[model samples]
Target: MERCIDGVCSGIFGSAVFSDTVMQERLPKPIYKKLKKTIKEGLPLDPEVAEVVACVMKDWAVEIGATHFTHWFQPLTGVTAEKHDSFLTPTGDGKAIMEFSGKELIKGEPDASSFPSGGLRATFEARGYTAWDCTSPAFVKDKTLYIPTAFCSYNGEALDLKTPLLRSMEALSKQAIRILRLFGDTTTKRVVTTLGPEQEYFLVDKELFMKRKDLIYTGRTLFGAKPPKGQELEDHYFGILKEKVSRFMHDLDEELWKLGVSAKTKHNEVAPAQHELAPMFATTNIATDHNQLTMEIMKKVADRHGLACLLHEKPFAGVNGSGKHNNWSISTDDGRNLLDPGTTPLDNAQFLIFLVAVIKAVDEYADLLRFSVATAGNDHRLGANEAPPAIMSIFLGDELTSVIEQIETGVVKNNGTSRTLEIGVSTLPVLPKDNTDRNRTSPFAFTGNKFEFRSVGSSQSIATPNFIINTIVAEALSQIADRLENAGDFRAEVNAVVKEIISKHKRIIFNGNNYSEEWVAEAERRGLPNLRTTVDAIPALIAEKNIRVLEKHGVLNRAEIYSRYEICLENYIKTIRIEALTMIEMASRQILPATLSYVRKVADTVASLRAADADYSCVKEELDELVTLTSGLKAAIDKLDQKIKEADASEGDSLSHARAYKDVIIPQMNELRAVADRLETIVDASLWPIPTYGDLLFGV
Candidate 1:
C-alpha cells in the first residue's frame, strides 16, 4: 500500500520499486542500456545479457516474498497461461536451498498436449517451449514471479498469440523505418504499434448471478424473459455508478495499477449493469499482456467485492452488448505520432503516406482483418444494431474526406481559402477547426490521430487483431516504400502512390452511415467483403492471399495459419454446442418443472373454488389455457433436445459441423426458448429456479 505523488496507494509495484529500485539497481548500466535499446529499437535479445537480467529478476522477486516463478504466456485459448515451479532444491542433510537459475528463468516446459493446439502438436507430442520476452519486464503476482514470455511448439511452430504478434510488430517497424528514412527522419529508429483497448463488461450481484444456471454455465444468459425495463430510457449509459459497483471499480483499478496497467477510465456503458475500463496506450505486446491481466484482475477484484464480472460479448439479449474498442496508432521511437496529420495539409505528406497505407491495408486485407475479431461469443454481438457491421469501411470525417477527394480529382480542397481566426473581443483564444468528424458505426474509423477498431469483442485477446493490423499495414507500407525507392522523383512518387492507393482502394472508404441498408447495398456494389459470422469468416483465414502475406512477413507459417483456422472452427462449434446443451438442461430441469408446479397449483385452486362455490368455470378456463401452453412448451423442449443430440451425432469437417450447430441446433434451441420464456411470464416467480432478466440486469 505505497503511494506515489498521485496520493492513491501504489497498490503493490510502486513507481520507486519499478524505476529506481528494480531496474536501476538490478542491472549494470551497460546491460540496462542495451536492454532498453532492444525494447525501444525492436532489436534482438542477447542470450548472455538475458541470463544476467534473469538473476537480478529472481533476487528481486524472492525479496518480495515470491517462492515460485512462472513463465506467463498467452495461448490461443484467448487467455493467459502459466506453469509454476518452486525455487527450492533439496540438500543431502534434509535441508533445502532456494535456487532459480538464469536458464530456469528464461525458459519453461509445459505440456503441449492439453492446450488447444489446433493440430499444431499431437497428443503424443507433448513438448512446448516458453521463451522469456525480454521487452516486457517480469513482475510478481499472487506470490509468483510472472515472467512474460512467448510460447511455441517444440518444432518451432508458433503456438501462442503473442509470438506472431511480436513478429508482426517487428515486420511493421522494419517497413515503417524504411518510410521514415525516405521522409528524412533519421533520428526515429523504430516504429511501434500501440493500443489502448477499452474493455466493457457487466457486473451482477453474485447471489443473483449464481441463481441462473445459464449465466453460470455459458458466461451469458442463454435464455431469459425480457425485462420490463432495459436500457430503453438510456438512463444507465454513463450514469453515476452505484456504491457497490463503484467500490468494485475502485478496487479493480487499484489492483490493475499495481501491475503497471494504466487503468485510466471507468464508467457505465450503454446497458444497465454494464461498464467499461480504458487504459492508456502502450506497445501492442505489453498492452496485450496488460489486457489479459486486466481481465483476470477484474474478475478477482469483483469476487472480493461480492460480484461476478461477465466478459461475454452478448451476455444479455435485446440490449447493447459489450465490446472492446481497440484504439490503435503508430509512433516513432523518437516520440512522433505517425498518424497525426498536422494543421497544414501541404506540410503533412508524411502523415498522409502513413494514413493512406492504413486505408489501403484495410481495403486489401479487410477479410483477414475481419476474421481476427470473429469468435462464437462475438458472433452474437457483431452486426447487431448496436455494433458495427461486418463490412469493413474506413470512416474519415468531412475534412479528411474532402482532402482525399480533392487529391483524387487533382483539385485544391477548400478553394485555397484559409479563413483567419479572429475573436470579436480581440482577447479570446481562437483555433482552427479539425478536418474530420468522428464516425462510430464504421468498423475501422479514422479519428483525429488513430484508427478505432470498433468490432473487437470485449472478451477477445486483442493480440490477434493487432497482429493482423500490423501485418496488413506492413504490406501496404512495403508497397509504398518499393514504389518510392524505384521512382526518379521521390516527392512525385509519394504523391502518385497516395493517389493510386486512394483511387484503387477508394471503394473501401465510406462516409455514409455504416449501419444503413443503403450502405450494405453500396458495399455489395463496390465488391467489398461482408463476412458476417465466424462460419463465414473462418474460411478466409487460410485463403491464399492471406497465407502468402502472413508467410512472407514471417508472422505465421502455413502450418500455423492452418492450425489457427482449425482452432477457430473447433472453438466456434464447441461454444455453440455447450450453449445448446446448457439450454436443454435449463429447459428440462428448471423451466418445465417450474411451469408444471405452477400449473398444478392453479388446478388445485380451481378445484378448491368449485368445492366452495358453483361459479368456478372462469377459474377452470384459465387453468385449461395454462395447461395447453405448458404442454406445447414441454413438447418443444423435447424436440430441441432431440435436435441437439442429432447435431452431436453428425460429423464432418469443422466448418460443416459449425454450420450444423448454427443452423440446425441453434434454431431448435431458440424455439424451445420462445415457449419457455412465455411460460416464465405466466408462471409464478417463486417457483422459478433461475433469476429473470429483470432481476439480473437491474439488481446491481
Candidate 2:
C-alpha cells in the first residue's frame, strides 16, 4: 500500500496526511474554497455544488482503492455503526460500471427500529435517514469510502448523537455570531466549538480476553478478585510503553491516519494496562466523527496485534477506570482562539466576555452537564479516587479565579506589580498561566484555554456532551448579548453581567478536591445536586428547564429529548441486567462447579488422612471449613438469582425500572461477586474455571 511518510509527522499520527495541502489536493479548488467558507461562515451548502463535490470525492476515493461505501454514524448505543455497499453497477449484459451518484453519496436509509431510539421508533417503524455531513470529509479505509453522516428517524426526530450535536453546533454559532457582532467582530461571520477528546483504555491479550466470558460478553470482568500487584505501586502512569504495546500503538496510529483521524498523542495512563490517545483539535462535528472512528480503529487495529481493547469505564474493580477527557473551546474563522486571553487585559474584553459565558453556562447547568456523562459503566468509575466526582464543579486556575473575583468585588488587588510599555522598546511582561488551579478531581476543569470535561466515559461518543456544552454556552452568550446590545455602555454592561454571573453562581466553582467525602457533603450543603447514579442523572435529561433550553435553540424538540431520556435509562437498566445475568451464569456454571471440585479434593484428603491415622483432627477441620464456604457461595448465588428474577418481574417506565436495577439488582450482584471472589483465592489455580484478575491485568 502507498503511504505518505512525512518526516514532520513521523512521531505524530495525525501529522502525515490531513494537512491543509493534502485537503486542497483531495477537493476541487472551487468546491474546497466554498466548503471552507461554509465551515467558517456557517453558510448553507448548495445542492448543485454538493453534486460536483460528490463527483470529486468519488474519484478520489476510487483512486484510493475504495470499492465500497458506508455512512458512519454514532448511535445512542455509544458506538459506531455502518452498512457497506459495493460501488459497482451492471451497465449492460455482462459489463459492470463502477459508479456512485450524488444522491447516493448524500443520503442513506438504515433500519431505525433495530437501533435503540428510546421510545422514538416503534417496531413497525423501521425507516431512518443518514444525511452526509460534508464538513467532515469522506475518508477511505480498507477498500471502502466512509462518509460521516448524522442519523435521524423518518419522522425527522434525532435518533443519534451526531444530529443533535450538529444542531447544537449551529445553535452555538448563531448565538456566538450575535455576541461577536456586539463586539464589532463583523469579519468573523461564524464561531465554532472545537473539541479534542483524549481517550483512555486498556489493552489485554486477546487469548486471555477470550478465556473470560465476562470480558468477552460484557466488555468487563464481572467477577475478578483484586490483583496483588495493582496500581498501588503508581509506576504505570506515564511509564515507558512496553515493546508489544508500542508496536500495537504504532499499527493503530497508522490505521487511524489512513482514515484521516488525527490521533496526535499516545501515552501510558494511570492504571495498569491502561493507555491514552490524544488527538488534535477540530470543529466539533468533525471531531465527533474522528473520535468515533478513532475508537473503532483502536479496537480493530489492536486485534491485529492479538490484543483486546477494553473501552469500559470500569472494566475491573479496585483499579483506576478509563475516561475520555473532552477538551473543548470556541474559535473564530480568522485563526483566533476566543478562549485565549490577549496581551492587554483592557483590549481583550471581547475574549473575557466569551470566557465568562462558558463559566456561567457550566455553573447554571451543572447538573445537566453531569447528566450528559451519566452511564452505568461510568457510575462505577466516577467519584472513585482516580476519577473525578459526580458533582459538577469548575476549576479555573488561581489567576483567572482571582481575576473574576476581583471583577466581582470591584477590587483590583494587583496594585503594585505594574509594568509599563516603552515607546521605543518591547516591555510587554509575560503573563502567568494563572486561571485556576488544575483540579483533577473536578468534573469540569479549565486547563489553560479550554475546558476539560473529565466526566465523559471512555467508551462514550463525546458528541452528546459537546452538544450539551455548546447549547448551554450558546444560551448564556445569547443572554449576555441581549444585555450588552441594549445597554448604554458596553464595557460597563459586560463587566456588570460577568460580575453578576460570578456572584450568583460562584458556588459552582470549586478549586478543592471533588473526590473527597467532605466535598460531597459541602456540595450538598451548598445546594448542588449530587446525581450519584445513572438513574438519578437520566431524569435531568428531560427536565423542564433542559427541555426548554434544547427546544428554544432548535437543538432538539420535546419528542427527541424525551426519547433520549427513555433510551438512556433503558440502556442503563439493560446493561446492568445483562451484567447481573452474566454473573448468575458464571456463578452457576463455572464458579460453583469449581468450588465444589475443590471441596471434593479437600474432603478426599480428609478421608485419606483419617484412613491413615484415625485421629486427623486438622484434616477434618479443613474439610468442614471448605464445605461451609462452598455452601455459603452456593447460597449467595441463589440469592442473586432470586433478586435478578424479581427485578425482571417488576415493570414500569424505564426510569423506575432503572432505579430498581440499581437499588435492588446491583446489590445482589455485588453480594454474589464478593462470595465468588473469596472462593477464588481459596480454590486451587488448576481447579479455577476462569482467568483471575492477576492473569487478566498482568498477562500482556
lDDT of each: 0.84, 0.81
TM-score of 1: 0.94
Give the worst 10-residue stretch by lDDT in candidate 1.
421-430
Query: TM-scores of the models, in the given order?
Result: 0.94, 0.94
Tens-digit lDDT string for candidate 2 (603-658): 88888877887777887787787787788878887887888788778877777788
- Clash totals for all candidate models: 0, 8
Badly placed stretches (over 4 Å) of model 1 are 1-21, 343-347, 416-437
**Which parts of model 2 have CA positions greater than 4 angstroms off?**
1-23, 26-29, 122-125, 414-431, 434-437
Residue 617 lDDT (model 1): 92
Best by lDDT: 1
